[model samples]
Target chain A: DQQVKQNSPSLSVQEGRISILNCDYTNSMFDYFLWYKKYPAEGPTFLISISSIKDKNEDGRFTVFLNKSAKHLSLHIVPSQPGDSAVYFCAASTPGYALNFGKGTSLLVTP
Target chain B: DTAVSQTPKYLVTQMGNDKSIKCEQNLGHDTMYWYKQDSKKFLKIMFSYNNKELIINETVPNRFSPKSPDKAHLNLHINSLELGDSAVYFCASSQDPSGRVGDTQYFGPGTRLTVL
Candidate 1:
C-alpha cells in the first residue's frame, strides 16, 4: 500500500510563474515531510521540508505547506525558472522508520 | 568532490548473472541507505545501515543483499539477476537517525541496472 501519493503525474507552468505540486499521505504517524527534485538521470536532491509541528516552511523560491488535519502537503515554486523543470518527489517518514516516497510529479517550466 | 559516489553508473547484464554496485560517502555520516526506483518512478527503501550495522531491511527479495564494510561504504550485491531487477538504485547518507533531529539524506547520482 502506498502511504504517500502524488496525484498528479505531470505539471506544466510558464516561466516566472508559480508552480504548485500537491501531495497526500494516508499514514498519520508520519511527522516529517520533504520534497526532492530529480533530473533525467541524476538522483533526487533535497529541496524543502516541513515538520508536522509547523504548517509551512520556505526556502528562497520554494515553499512547503503542511495540513496535518487533511493529511496533505504542497510544494510551491514561485517564479518558476527553466532550471526548475524536473521530477519532484514527496517523501514522508516517522521518527526512525524508512521514508515512504510518492510516485513523483514531473514538472516542466516553459521558457 | 562528490559527497556521495556510486560506481558503474550503468550496468547491463544477462539473466542469472551476478552483479554488485559499490557506494561510498565522503560526508562522514554514520547512517547510509539504499533506495530503488522502478520504471514507474516509485522510489522505495531497500536497506539501511547505521555505523556498519543493519537498521532497516525492507521486504525485498532474498536475491538482493546489502553489505556495509564500513560506515563510509555500502555495497549492494545481487544474485541471479532477473528482468524485474532492472531499475535505478540510489544511495543516501544522513548524520544520524535517532529522531532527535530531523535528518536530511543526501543521495548519490544513482546507478541504472538493466537485467536482460
Candidate 2:
C-alpha cells in the first residue's frame, strides 16, 4: 500500500510565478515530512522539511505548509525559475530514519 | 566532495549472476540506507544501518544482503539476480536514526542495475 501519495503527476507554471505541489499521507504516525528535488540523471537533493509540531516552514523562496488534521502538506515556490523545474518527491518518516516516498510530481517551469 | 557516493553507476548482468554495489559517505553520518527504485519510479526502502548495526530490514528477499563495514560505508550484494531485480538503487545517509524530526537524508547519484 502507498502510505504517501502525490495525486498530481505533473505541474507547470510560468517563470517568476508561484508553484504549488501537494501531498497526502494515510499514516498518522509519520511526524516528519520532507520534500526533495531530483534532476534527470542525478540523485534527489533535499529541499525543505516540516515537523508535526509546526504548521509551516519556509526557506527563502520555498515554503512548506503542513495540515495535520487533513493529513496533507504542500510546497510553495515563489518566483519560480526555470532551474527549479524538476521532479519533486514528498517523503514521510515514522519514528525512525527510514523514509517512505511518494510517486513524485514533475514540475515544468516555462519561460 | 560527495557526501554519499556509489561506485559502478551502471551494472548489467545475467539472471543467475551475483553482483555487489559499494557505497560510502564522507559526511560522518551514523545512519545509512539502501533504496530501490523500480521501472515505474516507485522508491522503496530495502535496508538501513546505523553505526554498523542493522536497524531496518524491509520485506526483501534473502538473496539480497546488506553489509556495513563502518558507519561511513554500506554495501548491497545481490545473489542470483532475477529480471525483476533490474532497477536503480540509491544509497543515502543521515545524521541520526532516532527520528530527530528534522534530519535530512542525502542521497547518492544511484546505481542502475539491469538483469537479463
Candidate 3:
C-alpha cells in the first residue's frame, strides 16, 4: 500500500515564478515529513522538512507547509530557477521508523 | 568528497544469477539504510542498520540480504535474482543514534540493477 501519494506526476513552471508541489498521506502516525530532490542518474537528496508541531518551514527559496489535520503537505519554490528542475519526492515517518516515500513528481522550470 | 559511495553503478545480469552491491559512507554516521526504487518510481526502504546491528527489515524477499560489517558500510547481496528484482538501489546514512525520524539522510548515486 502506498502510504504517501503525490497525485501529480509532473509540473511545469516558468523561471522566476512560483512552483508548488503537493503530497498527501494516509498514515496519521507520521509526524515527520521531508522533501527530497533527485536528478537523472543520481540519488534523491534531502531538501526541506517539517515536523508535526510546526505548520511551515522555509529555507532560502524552498518552503514546506504541513497540514496535519488534512494529512497533506506541500513544497513551494519561489522564483523557480532552471536548475530547480528535477524530480521531488515526499517522505514521511515517525520516530525510529523507516520512511515511506511517494512516487515523486517531476518539475520542469523553463526559461 | 563523496559522503556516500556505492560500487558498480550499473549491473546487468541474467535471471537466477547472484549479485552483490557494496556501499560505504565516510560521514561517520551511526545509521545506514538501503532503498530500492522500482519501475513505478517508488523509493521503498528495504533495510536499516544502526551501529552494525539490524534495526528494520521491510517485506523484502529472502533472496535479498543486507550485511553491515562496520558502522560505515552496508552491502546488499541477492541470491537467485529474479526479473522483478531489477531496480535502482540506493544507500543512505544519517547520524541519528537517538533514532530521530527526521534526521537528514545522505544518499549515494544509485546502482542500477538489470535482470534479464
Candidate 4:
C-alpha cells in the first residue's frame, strides 16, 4: 500500500510564475515531511522540510505547507525559474528511521 | 568530496544471477539505510543499520541481504536475481535513529540495476 501519494504525475509552469505541487498521505503516524529535488541521473537533493509542530516552512523561493488534520502537504515555488525543472519527491517519516516516499512529480518550467 | 557514494553506477545482468552493490558514507553518521526506487519512481526503504547493527528490515525478499561491516559501509547482495528486481538502489546515512537533533539523511547518486 502506498502511504504517501502524489496525485499529479507532471506539472508545467511558466517562468517567473508560481508552481504548486501537492502530496497526500494516509498514515497519521508520520510527523515529519521533506521535499527533495532530483535532476536527470542525479541523486535527490533535500530542498525543504516541515515538522508536524509547524504548519509551514520556507527556504528562499520554496515554501512547504502542511495540514495535519487533512494529511496533506504542498510545495510552492514562487517566481519559478528554468533551473527549477526537475522531479520533486515528497517523503515522510515517523520518529523512527525509515522514510516513505511518494511516486514523485515532474515539474517543467518554461522559459 | 562525495558524502555518500555507491559503486557500480549501472549494472545489467541476466535473471538468476547473483550480484552485489557497495556503499560508503564519509559523514561519520551512526545510521545508514538502503532504499529502492522502482520504475514508477517510488522510493521504498529496504533496510536500515545503526552503528553497524541491523535495525529495520522492511518486507524485502530473502534473496536480498544487507551487510554492514563498519559504520561507514553498507553493502547489498542479491542472490538469484529476477527481472522484478530491476530498479535504482540508493544508499543514505544519518546521525542516528529516534529523530534526535541531527537525523537528516544524505543520499547517494544511486545504482541502477537492470535484470534481464
Candidate 5:
C-alpha cells in the first residue's frame, strides 16, 4: 500500500505563472515532509521541506504548505520558469525510518 | 565535487548472473542508504548503514546483500539475479537522522540495471 500519494500525474503551467502541486498521505506518524526535483537524466535533489509543527515553509520562489488535519501538503512555485519543469516528488519521513516517496508529478512549464 | 558517485552507471546481464554496484560519497557523512526505483517509478529504500554498521534492511530478498566497508562506501550485491531485479538503483548519504538540516540525503546519478 502506498502511504503517500500524488493524485496528479502531470501538470502544465505557463512561464511566469504560479504552479501548485498536491500530495496526500494516509500515515499520520509522518512528521517531516520533503519535496525533490528531478530532471530527465538526473536523480532527484532536495527542494523544500516542512515540519508538522509549521503550516508553511518557503525558499525563494518555492513554498510548501501543510495541513495536519487533512494529511495533505502542497508545493507551490511562483513565477514558474522553464528550468522548473521537471518531476516533483513528495516524500515523508518518520523518526528513524526511511523516506516514503510518491509516484511523482511531472510539471511542464512552457515559455 | 561529486557528493555521491556510483560505478557502472548502466549494467545489462543475464537473469542468472551475479553483479555488484559500487557507491562512494565524499560528503563525509555517517549515514548512507540504497534505494531501488522500479518500472513504475516508485523509489523504495532497501538498506541503510551508519558508520560501517548496518541499520535498516527492508523487505528485500536474501539474494540482495548490502555492504559498507567504510563510512563513505556502500555496495550492493545481487546473486542469481532475476528478471524482476531490473531497475534503477540510487545511493544516497545523509549527516544523521536526528532531523537536522544536514540530514537531507544527497543522491547519485543512479545505476540502471537490466537483467534479461
Candidate 6:
C-alpha cells in the first residue's frame, strides 16, 4: 500500500510568488519527512526536511511544515524561481527504515 | 566531484537478458541503497546495505540481487530481465541507516533501464 501520498500531480506558479506543495501519510511511525526536487534526466536532490519533533523547518527559500496530528506536511517555497521548476517528491521514514515516497508533484515556475 | 555515481546512465536490453548496474559513492558513507521508480513514478526501495551487509530487502523479485563489494560500492544484478523491469533505478547513500535527525541521503543521477 502507498503510505505516503501527494495528491497534486502538478502545480504552476508565477516567479517570485509563493509555491505550496502538500503531502500526507497514513503511518504514524514515520518521524522524519523530507522533500526532494528532480529535474529532467537528473536525480532527485534533497531540498529540505523536518522531523516530527518540530512543526517547521526552513532553509533559504524552502521550508517544510509538518503536522503530526493531522498526518500531513507541506513544502513552501518563497519567491519561487524559474529554476525551481521540477518534480518534487515527499518522503517519510521511521527509525531504521527506508524511506516511503509519494508519487511526486511536478511544479512549474513561469516567468 | 560527484558524491554518488551510477554507471551506464541508460541501459536497453531484450527480455531474458541479464544485466548489471553499478553504483559507487565517494562520500565515505557506510549505508547504500537501491531504489526503483516505476512508470507511476513511485520511488520504492529495493535493497539496502550497511557496511557491506544486507539489512533491508523489500518484496522484490528473486531475479534482482544486490551486492556490495565494499563500503563505497554497491552493485545490482538481474538474472532474467522482463518488460516489467523497465524503470529508472537510483542509488543513494547516507552516513547511516539509523534515521537520525541529520542523517541525509544523497542520490545518484539514476540509470534508465529499458527491457524489451
Once fitted onto the true fold, the runs of candidate 5 whose alpha carbons sit more than 4 angstroms away are: none
Please estimate how well model 4 matches the true structure, expressed as its whole-model Cα lDDT. Answer: 0.92
My TM-score estimates for the predictions, one after another, are 0.97, 0.97, 0.97, 0.97, 0.98, 0.98
**Cα displacement (Å) at residue A3, model 5:** 0.7
Off by over 4 Å in 1: B98-102
Q: Decide which is better by DockQ, 4 or 5.
A: 5
Error of 5 at A68 (Å): 0.6
Predicted candidate 4 versus true structure: per-residue lDDT over B1-116, tens digit per residue: 99999999999999999999999999999999999999888999999999999999998999999999999999999999999999999998989563333567888999999999
Residue-level lDDT of model 3, residues A1-111, one tens digit each, is 999999999999999999999999999999889999999999899998888999999999999999999999999999899999999999998877888899999999999
Using DockQ, give the best candidate's number: 6
lDDT per residue (tens digit) for residues A1-111 in model 6: 999999999999999999999999999999999998999998888888888999999999999999999999999999999999999999999889998999999999999
lDDT of 4 by residue, A1-111 (tens): 999999999999999999999999999999899898999887887788899999999989999999999999999999899999999999888887577889999999999
Give the CAPRI class of candidate 5. medium
After superposition, candidate 2 runs with Cα above 4 Å error: B98-102
Q: Lowest summed-lDDT stretch of 10 residues in model 4 chain A?
A: A91-100
Best by lDDT: 6
Clashing pairs in 3: none
Better of 4 and 5 by TM-score: 5
Q: On residues B1-116, what C-alpha lDDT tens digit does candidate 6 reach at each position?
A: 99999998999999999999999999999899999999999999999999999999999999999999999999999988999999999999998684455668889999999999
Give DockQ: model 6.
0.74
Separate DockQ for every predicted complex: 0.64, 0.69, 0.63, 0.63, 0.64, 0.74
lDDT of model 3, residue B109: 99
Give lDDT tens digits, candidate 5, residues A12-87: 9999999999999999999999999999768889999999999999999999999999999999999899999999
